[model samples]
Each structure stands twice: as C-alpha cells, then as structure tokens.
Target: MRGSGQIVNRRRMIAGAGAAVLGTLLPGGAGAGRATDNALLPKLTDGRHWRIGYAETMPYGNYAGTLASIVKGLDALSWLNGAARMPYDAGQTDSQALWRWLSAHDLGPRIRFVADGWYGGLDQAPAEPILQRLESGGDIDLMIVMGTIAGRKLAVDRHSVPTLVFSTTNAVAAGIVAAAEQSGRDHVWAHVDPQRYYRQLRIFHETFGFRRLGIAYENSPAGRAIASIADIEAMAGQLGYELVARHVQAPAGPDDQERYYADLAAAWSDLAQRVDAMYITFGRWSLDRFPALVRVFQERGIPTFSQLGPEEVAQGALMSVARGDFDGIGQFGASVIARLANGERLADMRQIYFDTPTIAWNLAVASRMGYRPAMSALLAADNIYTSLRAVP
Candidate 1:
C-alpha cells in the first residue's frame, strides 16, 4: 500500500499489483499491461497545460463531499506534478483546502476550469449545453462527469475526449460501462462505489437483528440508478429480512422542495409503523430533504442508516457506510487522469472503484433508539459521533 501523503505509482500499481485486488472485488480484470514502470508525473502536451472540464447533475445538492474529493484529487495531482507546496489545514473541507492551495500557489494560470454545468434536475438544464461546451472548444483534454445520470448520458454519447465518471453508483446498471473491468467506449472510464445498502443491511441485521428495514428513495434517474427497489428486494431476500420501501417522486423545482418533504414525512410515518429500522439511500431529492427526513426518523425512534457520506453520519444518522474519501478518491482519479494526459490509452487504464469505504456511527442516535452495536462493529467504524450536534 502507498504511504500517507505519498503519490501512488500508477504505472506499476495498475499494471498488475492493483489488478490482483481489483480482479476479486470487481467483475472482470484482464488485458492490462504488466510492466512495473516508475513514471508518476502526468505528461501534458507541450506548450498547453492539461484542461479538465467538469459537469455535475446537481452541483448544489449534497455534492459537497464529492466536490471536496475532486479538489483533493486535483491538489494531489498538482503536488505530484511539481507544483509549489501550500499550507495544509485539516479543519477545512477538501474544496476549501484546494482553493487555499490554489490561491497560495497562484496556479490559476496553469489549470483551466471549463463547462462547469449543473443539470439542476432531469429537465431543468438539459445536457445539450454541456455537450456544446465540450464540442465548441475542442481544447478540453479531459472531462469529469459528477453524477450517475449525467455520467450515463455522457458515456453513451459520442465524444473523443478521455472522460472520467466520478461518484456514480452502479455504473454498469446505469449503462456507464459494459462491466467493471471494461469500458464499452474506449474514451470513457468510471469510478463507481458499490451500493452501501447491501453491506449496511447486513451489518444492521448482525448488529440489531432487525427483520424489517425501511428505505426512502427518489424516483429520478439518479435516484433509481443509485439504489433500486429491485436490488433492495433481492438483498433483503438473501439476508432473510423484509423491506418496506417508500418511493418519493423527484422534485420538479424549488416550489416542490417543501412538498417533497411533506410526502417523505408521510412515508416515514408509514414506514415507522411497519419497519424496525430505516436505511436512507442517496438521491438528490432525498438528500436535499435529509434534515427533515432524519428528524422524522428520530421522532419515531427509528434507528436509521444512511449511505451518503461522513457528513451525514456526523449530522445524526445512527450509522452509515460513508463513501466519500475525497483526498483518496481525488488522488486515485488524478493519477489516472494524469496517466491519460501522458498519452496512456483509456483501454489500458482500468476502471476502478473507491474500495476504502468509511464506517460511521452516531452514538447519540444509537442510544436514543436503545441499540448497542457489537464491540467489533464499534471498533471497525472509521468515524463516530457522540452527540446530535453537528460537527463542523
């Protein structure tokens, strides 16, 4: 494993060493180069610094964690590429930290940010503008699609730039990739994190022995793609547990935010009567209304599990398998992007998943629900909160 703060040797690691682990974790892993090369720095085209175009489905909605990760990855890329060292602050989020670093180093000139578009909802801002940005200016060397829906469309559309799809769940199911090992399109690669519901459900079963699990999800493309009712049913069957699901329609506009919450509160009330515990999956609509939904669960004395990020666990969720490791994901993605800039074929670069997931627990919520997790489970958690108070 690479040491902390050290840049990973992408050439050597991805060639074979990393493949050994990924092969087992992912579906297919073959046809990769086996050389232990030491070239770590990204090779940008002469006289032109590499430009990264970023696109998001919902930039303002629960995407801070992912944005932070992308910043961390870019920071790591700057550091490994011989940029000046900047002050590191553990207190700031990854996005904040990146801004400070960029300001300090005056790297505004070297890197360019282009086509920063957010498709607010399915119909709000169509992806055509994003495509136009990428197409009009043929200068974009790389593209980063931030959400599952946006990623799905971009991966399927014909484009020549090497693209990285980040923070998407079930990329294969969403049609972003042919398989974990193979990108159906030679120009696109995805970094997907497996659904947290299955693992969290297993843990909940082992910990509390809950037979009925309640879930609330949105009905949008991103919502359905993130965690589906069908997948939940299959997992529930395998685990010998029952699922009580509440499906909320995707919010249309700002006016629908309150309405969405009202509907979710009703759903939570309904699930509260039937289910023993709650598992909140990631969706723009559901995540935007998280505070209200969590309050509903808490008021009902339902121990809740979420699949958002550490921030959600820190807020109040009983426990969560948080999937945002901004620095780590950033480093890994940046390395791959760097390699691509250095003229490596996208086919040779394997599509990877962020495997180092963090387990987070809120002791206050656990106590309120009269649930005591096993010592092993407690010990295994990467993050723990003791109060209902939010951590800044």
Candidate 2:
C-alpha cells in the first residue's frame, strides 16, 4: 500500500501534468457519453491567436469571470499550437463592438468570431440577409451554434463554414448530428447533457428518495426541443424515477409576467400530487419568470432543479446546470472556433458544457417546507456552494 505522503505527492504530480497538457488534444478528445482521459485535455498557450464569443453571460461568470476563464482557456488552447486568442463579447449586439474589440488581434493568424448564439438561441430566423451574413464566410474559419442553432433550420445551403455546437440534449433530433455521439457530415460536437442532468437527478433521488420527478417546459419549439431528448427518459428509467412532463403554452399580452407565474404555480400544484421532485427549464426565451417560481416550489415540499439560468440560482436555488461557464466558455469555445479558423472543419467540431462550481441552497427554504437534506449526503457532494442554515 502507498503511504499518505506518497499519495499526496502523486496527486500533485498529476495536477502539474494536467496543467502541462492544456492546449494539445489528449489521447482521446471529448466525445458524447465517452469516458474522458484525465491525462489528455489539451494545454493552454500553444501560441495560436484567435477570436471567440459567448452568447450568454450570467452564471458563466459576469463579464470579468468570463474573460478570465477565456484567457486561461486560451493559455491552455495555445500551449502546443503556439496560439494566442482575440476574444469578443457575445453579449454585445453592435458590429462596431465586434470590430473594435477584435481589430487589434485579427492582424496575425486570425480566428474571428463570425457569430455565436446566446445559449445557442439565434437572434433571428434562418432567412437572408441573416442567412446571407452567415453564408458569406470571409477570413472567418468556424461557425458555432448551440442547441437550436444547428437544427434543420440552418441547413438552407450547402456550405463549408466548419461548425461546432455545445450543450445540446437533442442534437440528433435537431439534425445537428447523425446520432448521439457521431457527426452528421464533417461535423463534430462536445455536449454536457449526456451525464450532467442524470447526475443531478440521481443526487435528488438519494436525498429525497423520490421515485418520480416532474419536469415542466413551455409549450414552444424550444420546450418541445428538450422534451424530445431520449437520454432523459433512459436515465429516469435507470434511476427508477419517473418523469411527469407538462406543456403550458407561452403566455401572451403585456402582463405576460403575471400570466407566466400563474401558469407555473398551477403546474407545480398539480405536480406535487404525483412527483417526488420538480424540474423546470425556463428563462428569457421561455418565460423569464423567476422569484415567483422559487416561491411555488417552496410553498410545496417538492425539491426542484433545472437549467434555471445562473442569475436565478445565484439568488438562491439548490442547483442549476447550463451551457456556458460565462468566463471559461469563451476560452474553450474560442479554441474550438480557432481550430476552424486554422483549417479545422466546422462540420467536425461541437460545443461542450462545463460544470458549475457553486451550489446555492438555502437551509431556510428547506425548513419552511419541512425537510432537511442529509448531512452525510451534502458533505459527500461534489461541491457545496451555499449556506442556508447554521449548525446549532
């Protein structure tokens, strides 16, 4: 057996070794549902200079955090390739912002950010002049689309703007890939949903011992987009936890906020009767309803989880998983885009999701509902991000 000191030394060596390889591809690059080679996630600062973008900014770390991670990721991405990155703010809508932020860096070995969808949601439909701008690829190298961006909608023309996308649950259904883990044409992808959601659900099952979990989505294209995921059903079955799904149409009129909350309240009220836990996946696009949704789950004892945008979680929710790390996303994302700029095929790349380090749980909310998360369980958790109660 190894001594503790030897074990500690070995772990340190491992950390150093991981840092050493941040830019070059590990033995096995990221694959959908494939095991990761702890030894092989490329290193930073390979010396390649490029520009990448992040469509969404909240939980991904505010403007500052997002940039920090991108720089770190760029260091890793450029490590072997001798790459340096020219990054852009996806949150900004003006082209002048794009040009001003990117001009200085585009001078040498340029990898420009042509377009990025916030959470992969497009700013407009698949029509030219929009499609025209997308198709007219210039010094541009890769085009990345998250979630619905690559669905059947964007295949309007046969083009070679090598593409990559990330965090998609229904990639195949959306026609982005031919199968869950393989590419459709020359395309490739890195996704976060193959395991994250299932892991989150399993933790919920262990904590509350809930046999059935209810998930609600808006009755819209994007909502139905998530509902079509085969993995969710497969994972739920394996956990022996059932799914109760509801589809409430998107609200209409000026007081949409009020209507949205009212509908969600009723959904949970109905779910409480059958589900052991509740799951929601709504935000700016779906409903933009917050504080009230938080109240609904609390009023009832149903433990909840979802892709509740980082802001909502930061305010105080037990957990939320999502598309961008805000800060780190641009780095990795830009790297993938960089590959395209350098001659990597867009069709051969895909987006990937990074796990959040924070877990926001309020012990007060737990008490108001008459429940306590197991201490041993919480301690054993992958990470503990918030304090809702004090130990007496």
Give the TM-score comparing model 1 with the true structure, all chains together.
0.76
For model 2, give the 10-residue run with minimal summed lDDT.
Answer: 1-10
Candidate 2, residue 98: the lDDT equals 35
Give lDDT tens digits, candidate 1, residues 59-128.
4323445544555555555523223354433323333334344334445434554433323343245677
Q: What is candidate 2's lDDT per residue for 175-243, written digit by digit as tens? A: 556655446566445343345555555545655777777877665655565554355667777878777
Question: Model 1 segments beyond 4 Å from truth?
Answer: 1-36, 59-111, 114-124, 194-197, 219-222, 228-230, 285-289, 323-325, 389-392
* lDDT for position 241 in model 2: 76
Q: Provide TM-scores for the models.
A: 0.76, 0.64
Highest-scoring model, lDDT: 1
